[model samples]
Target: MKLKMSIVDAFADKLFKGNQAAVIVLERWLDEKLMQDIAAENNLSETAFLVKEKNDIFNIRWFSPLCEIDFCGHATLASAFILFKENEALTSIKFYAKAVGNFEVYKKDDGLIQMNFPKREPVKVQEFPNELLEGLSIKPKEIYKNVQAYFAVYEKEEDVLNIEYKSELLKKLAPYDVVVTSASKNREYDFVSRYFWPASGGKEDPVTGSIHAGLTPFWANKLNKNILVALQASKRTGVLFCELKEDRVLISGKAVQYLEGNISV
Candidate 1:
């Protein structure tokens, strides 16, 4: 079978920056194993697969090389970018995920794709697991946890940047990734973060949109602001514009198409 595939760099204005996601548009759902195999072959952070349910609505799923994940921000943005480019009349698109429920993406007048994602607010944890601490070279000032990952709060941006981790130790924190973040010293951004998911994807994620959903709310409350700018300080850096609403978060960023072609399976 021949399927259409697109590779997009989300949260970036140029190529080789930000997170790369593989997006495959299908007429119908493929076998679960087949999708997983495709994702593994692609070897990207997250590969998104979608089947059109109706006009402007799609049934979406995300897979890492190892397993299926509940939510993914960059791949969703990449899918919307492909759809919008294909159909100019499409101002917006709705996506339904089995685990994350329904979400919408709108094409802003300024040419940014804005996604309305469910807000994930994490509460402070009194104690962190031993593995969590042993995995990192530096200790955090405080720690918090949400449904997806553990947030390790640090005092300085340099602390976040200088972190080194043992991937084997991080694997002990299975099913939950770790995010090390701190208030940005640079005036251009409000906060900076780096995501490590050795148990699932890899040692690091270039730019994580889902984690920012939690990061936005946490920092917004700390900074006493509703809107904020975030930077993921990985080797391939990216920026995100985030806002915390009552029950949802608005994550907006620009995506650039890296490669487009046909994949035969």
Candidate 2:
């Protein structure tokens, strides 16, 4: 069998700067194992498989090499990029993930794709796990947790940049990952973050738009502003424009296509 696929550099203005996601729009859902095998074969952080449900609504699922993911921002944005590229008149699309309910994505006049995700505001955690403490070179000043991962708040942007991860110790956190973040020194961005998910997709995510749902609200309250800009401090860094809407966060970024081809199974 043959299938069409696209590799997109999401959250990037230009090629090779952002996280890469493999997107496959299918006529029907493939077997669960097939999808997982495909993700492993593609070897990207996340491979998004989309099946059209209606006029502009589609069922989307993401898989990593190791396992399936509940939520994935970059891959979703990549899927939207494929859809919009196919139909330029399309201004908006709704995606339904089995794990996370329906969410909307829009193509703005400015050419960025905006996603509306639930506000995943994390609560401060008074206790710390030994694994978390031992995994990093520099410890965070405070820690918080939500459904996705543990949020580690640092005092300076330098701390965020300098911290090193002991993947062995960090992956012990399993099921949950870690986020290290601090206010950016750069005048252009509001906050900066680095994602470490030894338990999930990869060692580091080049740009993470999903985590910004939690980060946006955290920084918004910290800086006393609803609108903020973020920089993912990974080696191949990327920028995200964020807004803390009422019960949701609006995350926007640009995606560029890296490659297109056919996959045979």
Candidate 3:
């Protein structure tokens, strides 16, 4: 089969300086093995597939080079961007997926894509395991747990930016990924964060949107505000505008379509 794919740099105001995600629009869902193979071959942080159906809704899935993820923000932006560019009639896209259960993407008049995702509420833990601590280097000021993985929060943003985890060790402890975040008290933004998923087939993700689902609510309660602006402090940093509503997070970002072509298998 031939797959038409596009490489998009999301949350980038300019080209080549944002998180890159491969967006593929498919007629229907492919076999599980084939999807993994394609993701491995692409070797991107995340590759998103969108399958359009009879109704206005579409089915979406995200895979990293190593494994399929429950949810991903940057790739969702990429997929929405592709749909907007390719189908003028599709002014807005609603995506239903198996990963995070279900999410929707809508196109904005200002040319940005917005995603509504589940909020992963994190509660404080007594202490983080030494194995997990070894990877992050910084002793977390606070730790949180949810359904998938653990989250560690630092006292300061500088520490968040300076974190250097031992990738090999972190991979062993984290079930899916480890997120380290800090309140950006010194900066204009509300928070700064990073994601390390060495266990799930990567060292450090350039920018992560999914992790923010946990962060948004955590900071929202701390800051006593439901809205926040976040910056993912990866080498190629990305910005996310977030809103913490009841059980969902509204994530907004810009996407730049860089390349489009077909992959033959």
Candidate 4:
């Protein structure tokens, strides 16, 4: 079967600046293993597959090279970007992820795609994992946990930037990943962060929008701001404009399309 595929750099102003996600929208859902194989072939962090359930509404799923993800923000942004570009009349789109429930994505006047996601505020972990302490070069003072990842709080942005990781050590903490973050030194942005998910097949994600659901609430409470700007301090850096509302987090970023073609499945 011939399927359409496109690669988009999400949370990026230009190509090669943000995390890349493979997007495929179809009339029906493909077999689970086939989708996984396709994602593995793509070799990106996340590949998003969708089927239009109704007008401006689609059922979506995300997969990493190794396994399916519970929630993925960048790929969702890419999906919205593709759908918006495909039809100019679509001002907004709603997605239903069986794993994480439903959310909405809409285009703003500034050309940024804004996603409304659940606010996942991580609480302090009572028992810290030994692997977390050994996996990083710098030990964080406190750690927190939410639905997806463990939050490692740092004192300085440089700590988050310069810290090295042992994949094997972090891999031991399976079922949950890690995000190291700190208040940004650059006054232009409120906070800085880096995502590492050795267990789920990604290492140093370029820009993770899903993790920001937790990160935004964490930082917003700490920094005492409802709205903030975030910088993902990876080699291919990207920025996120964030806002925290009642029980929700609004994350907006720009996505640039890099490649489009057809693939046989």
Candidate 5:
């Protein structure tokens, strides 16, 4: 079968800046193994497969090169980008995921896509795992853990940038990734962060929107503010506008189309 595939750079105004997610719009659900193979073939951080459920609703799933994940923010934005571009009349779209539940994406007047995601507020963990500390070259001032990943709080943005990960050790922290972050030195941004998921996705993620769901609330409480700007300090960087609500986090960014073609499977 021939399937339509598009690569979109999410959280970036231009191509090759943000995380690239491969999005495929499917009319029906394909076999799980086939979808996994497709995602592995794409070899991106995340590949999104979606099937339209209604006029404005879609059921979506995300997969990394290694396995299917419960949630992925960039791929969802990329999918919304494709849907918006295809139908100008569409101002918003609702996406349902099996484990993550429902999320809504709206097109702003400024051309940014705003995603309403559940707040994943992390709590301080009293005991720091030895493997987690051993996996990183730098020691964190504080550490927090949630369902998804570990949050490593650093003293400065420079520390976050200078981190060298021991991928082998990180692999020991399977099923959970690590996020190292600190207050941004740059005046334009409120905080800076880098994500590492050697055990799950890759050694490093260019720009991650899903983690920001937890990061936003964590920083907001620490900084004593509700709205903030975050910059992911990966080689291919990206910026995100985050707002912390009572039970949800609003992540907003722009996505640009990188490639579009047909995939034969």
Candidate 6:
């Protein structure tokens, strides 16, 4: 079958500067194994698949090269962008996704898309595994565990920028994904972070909006702030405007379309 696909760079003001996601539109659900194969073939951070459910509603799923992820923010943005471009006449769209315990995507009036995601509260863990730190040059100040992944706190912002480690060791130690975050003393940003997910797929994800659901609240409580600016310090960095609401976290960013084409398989 031939499928229409596009690559979107989410959280980017320009092309080639953010997380790249492959989006595909399907008439019906493909076999789970085929989806995995397609994701592996794409070899991108995340490949999003969607099918029309109604006039405005669509079903979405995200997969990495290695495994199916519960949620992926950048890919969702990519999917929305594709829909907007393809169906230019349609101003609004809704997506019912299996990610993040069943979530919805809304296309906004101002070209900005919003996703209502689940709140993943993190619990403080006593310590991190020795192997997890052995490969890295520095140590995290604290460690916390969430349902999706774990957060590793660092002491300095410079440390976050200059992080260099062995991906193989991190993959071995971490069960899922590991987030390296630090309080930014810099006046520019409230926090700086890097996400490493050797197990689930990408070695270093450029910008992770879903992880912020846990991170925004954790830092808000620690620093006693309601709204803050966050930076993801991967090779392709991003600036996220985040707010900690009573029950849910709101993550906002800009996305750009990188490529649009068709794929045959």
TM-scores for the candidates: 0.98, 0.98, 0.95, 0.98, 0.98, 0.91
**Candidate 6 Cα errors over 4 Å, as ranges:** 54-56, 88-92, 107-111
lDDT of candidate 5 over 14-115, digit per residue (tens): 878999999999999999999999999999999999999866579999999999988899999999999999999999999999877888999999988999
lDDT of 4 by residue, 23-85 (tens): 999999899999999999999999999998866579999999999998999999999999999
lDDT of 1: 0.94
- Winner by lDDT between candidate 3 and candidate 2: 2
TM-score of 5: 0.98
Candidate-wise lDDT, in order: 0.94, 0.93, 0.85, 0.93, 0.93, 0.81
Residue pair clashes in candidate 3: none
Which candidate, 5 or 6, has the higher lDDT? 5
Question: Mind sharing the TM-score for model 1?
Answer: 0.98
lDDT of 3 by residue, 1-265 (tens): 6788899999887887668999988888899889999999989899988888788678888998988887788888888888888888776777888768667788878877889999888887786677787777778888887765678888888998998899888878757578888889755699998888887859888888788888899899999999899998899998889999899999999988889999998
Pairs clashing within candidate 1: none
User: Model 2 segments beyond 4 Å from truth?
Assistant: none
* Candidate 4 residue spans exceeding 4 A from truth: none
Regions of candidate 1 where Cα sits further than 4 Å from its true position? none
lDDT of 1 by residue, 1-265 (tens): 8999999999999999999999998899999999999999999999999999867579999999989989999999999999999999999999999767999999999988999999999899997899999999999999999999999999989999999988999898888999999999899999999999999888899999999889999999999999999999999999999999999999999999999999999
- Winner on TM-score between 3 and 6 is 3
Backbone Cα, N, C clashes tallied per candidate: 0, 0, 0, 0, 0, 0
**lDDT (10s digit) by residue, model 2, range 1-265:** 9999999999999999989999999999999999999999999999999999866589999998989999999999999999999999999999998767899999999999999998999899999989999998998999999889999999999999989999999899988899999998999999999999989987988888889999999999999999999999999998999999999999999999999999998
